[model samples]
Target: MLKPPYYPIIYVRGYAGTQEAVEDTVATPYMGFNLGSTKYRQTSAGKIEPYVFESPLIRLMKDHLYQDAFHDGQILPQGPVSPRSIWIFRYYDVVSKGLGNGERKEIEFHAEKLRQFILHVRSATGQDSNKDFRVYLVAHSMGGLVCRCYLQNKDIPDLEGKPPGDWKKKGVDKLFTYATPHGGIEFRKGFGWLEGLRDFLAINNADNFGKTRMREILSLEKNLPLHSLNNRFPAKRVFCLVGTNSQDYGISRKVVGPKSDGLVQIENAYVKESARAYTFRSHSGAYGIVNSESGYRNLERFLFGDIQVNVSLETLKIKMPGKEKNLSATYDIENNVSIRGLPIPVNKRTKDTFSSSFRSSDTLEEERTHLFTSFLLKTARLNKRRQSLGFSIHFRILPLYHQDKRFLPDRHYEGQAVFDDRLIIEVSKGGDSRFKVRYGWGSNNFKATKNLEFKVDKNNLSTAVIQLNQHRPVNMTAAIRFEVSAWN
Candidate 1:
């Protein structure tokens, strides 16, 4: 059998509140239940539900721009290439009746519908069952989750039952998702108010309504025993398109934190182990990510990128002590400040007078200085005059006073600094100590500069003497700080 030039693109819509809501607002008349002025309702659970609205894909192709393409007896526009077939599969939400049940049933219904749709396409195209044809799944929001459910569930018998062979190699090319919560959302943090309102309405049990159950089902730990990668199809075939612009609507306004595409947090949109993930100029709002131009372009790339790309974090290096440190290390780029791999306990105490600014005049500075000094003094006293504790400091220096034009208005000075312990020292009876210091310095315009300094002392475990002006120019504006830890 000759392979078709293009694969059919299937679009799936997100959660439509109810059958009535879908028919009335979400989808257009022809694509919705208003076709021929006759409302068609889906029947489930011994009740009649409004016809689930079709996705934008079908609306765009059939009822919108390319409507004539699929019209009966219509001739193709004369061109080098002829048009290929496109199909759409629409599924109803179990809660579309507003009765609130069947989250799992919804997934199963969509999966079965997709299978039937694929069979119908194959029969219509007259393709051999043994030959694999490209299948592109374009799902938005919970629709993506529903597709994942289909892919992860292997017990469903393949309707065609093609001979056991490399179907993937034949052409089962790709799966794409838009603004789908692959990682599951932190609904409480992002949509807390909506959740509260849903609870108030006593409609909290709705399936695919929030991130809670989706999270529970999609988690590696939870799904491992039931449908793990080892037991199910590899997830590397799936591609994710995430949204980063959150200004789409009121729903997008509720999500918390630094980055989001409005409805779904950027973090939740990308699946770590998926084949590929891309971010687009869309929000998590109902019509934003699904209908935007950027969304379509990214969807094309994800479906067609030569090689799939998976994102992950790499460990750079372990920062160690023994260098000429800076005084104002706050601006230093070398300052190894990561909450993930650090051992120091952060001071969480809130002092009424203390603020985050490190300026010498800030009320919090005095309290911080006092706290550090008192902590050191108590440690010295407890050691019985022995070198029981030690610290290494780092900082930066800038010519703030000499170069008025170069100084930053918002920043305290024009330099950066950082410090770490280079040597390990044990408490001695005489309270003497030896430690190495590493320092980094950088001007507002220049890249950072670094150097190492050594300090040796007797009976003074609290402070270290750094050799300055030895390795490079010491344009005084540099400040230094240190931390002391026992040898591990």
Candidate 2:
């Protein structure tokens, strides 16, 4: 009887390499949405092993009971379809002259058409066309920009100054973009003739991609502004899945840099202050973020799960006994996580480097005010025995950051880490309808944990506790509240 968050999904694929590539994409039935991944996962034993992750389409069917709209290798069926159906915005067909009439339109045209397509989906799903109906938007690369253009401004130029329908009001419940350049990408990473040419193509003001359509659409040329994050949907509803594996990204990696996911820079992939998660995934490939298990796990949780876990340090108990100058400390917060029996890190962070670091001076709200991560937890994934999740948080303190640390007691202090009790999160059941989640954490410095339970009727969303001092007897008194939206 689980429902509400269950709605139709509209997927928008990334940019094509060539006009021929566009043609090839149009020829495909699912527009690459059916692509799967075969990769390795690092277990608690610290071993890399094999794991096969079917495409997002298959996972959705296996987990949430969703299905596609096609039948007999042809178009949609004649009768009304279920609300739990998936659809791809076949946008490239309009751009490919071979697929459509020899007419190619700008992104504005596509945005307007997308609004109309939602109406079509409502009618097809047996819902009232004019009434409100929710749908999740999952886009990749430039498709994310196209989604923004539609959601932000009036895509179609109004002849009589009439505003278009409010898409957010029309029911865009959640948005998830994979490797999208929300802040516009830069090709200023490398050198050489070919590298210069790549930058030239993307930065050129003429019909070339650098300075032409892509640049114009993304506001890459200087001070042009984009209203996508400010208008329509709220920032919290958008999830940016950032990719950080640049070496495997092929040609684009030449100009993008070692810190990018091939084409889009990690810094440019997310909206400011919005929810984002990072992984060692490329922009688009067999190991791409959109096709991998980590990516799928994040997408599923954000779209269909309930609960959010925001953690931070409200107070620091660490103090230097001696009056020592030229000293600094950095804490690398890492969480070892597994979600719903999925063979991937739920936050998509790595075992070694996937974490947020803080400086000794960064104690105010402007510097340290944010959640560690947020995830969707489903009741179906629970076993009869535990009915909860298992995880561990470790703090790796480092001493560096251009500070004058010439003298030190022990050099080993630069690489110190603290590991504590493994945590288990539990949810309430039975007649406790107001109850959503219940769990316990921490003890008297070196003691065991105490029970901490939360209720949904009170908007129980997120919780956290951290140990600040590296010395003996830790104080785990950090007040943390996370902003979480319940999906199912």
User: What's the lDDT for all of these models?
Assistant: 0.40, 0.61
lDDT of 2 by residue, 185-248 (tens): 5675344455446656642121223334554554343444332355455777788888878877
* Most accurate candidate by TM-score: 2
lDDT of model number 2: 0.61
Model 2 ranges with Cα > 4 A deviation: 1-3, 40-49, 72-79, 101-104, 156-167, 188-228, 313-323, 348-366, 369-371, 384-397, 401-413, 418-424, 427-449, 453-485
Best by lDDT: 2
Give all TM-scores, in the order shown. 0.49, 0.79
**Please, what are the lDDT tens digits per residue for candidate 1 over residues 291-331?**
55434434443443221111111111112122433322221
TM-score of 2: 0.79
Please give the distance, in angstroms, between residue 347's alpha carbon in candidate 2 and its true position after superposition: 1.4
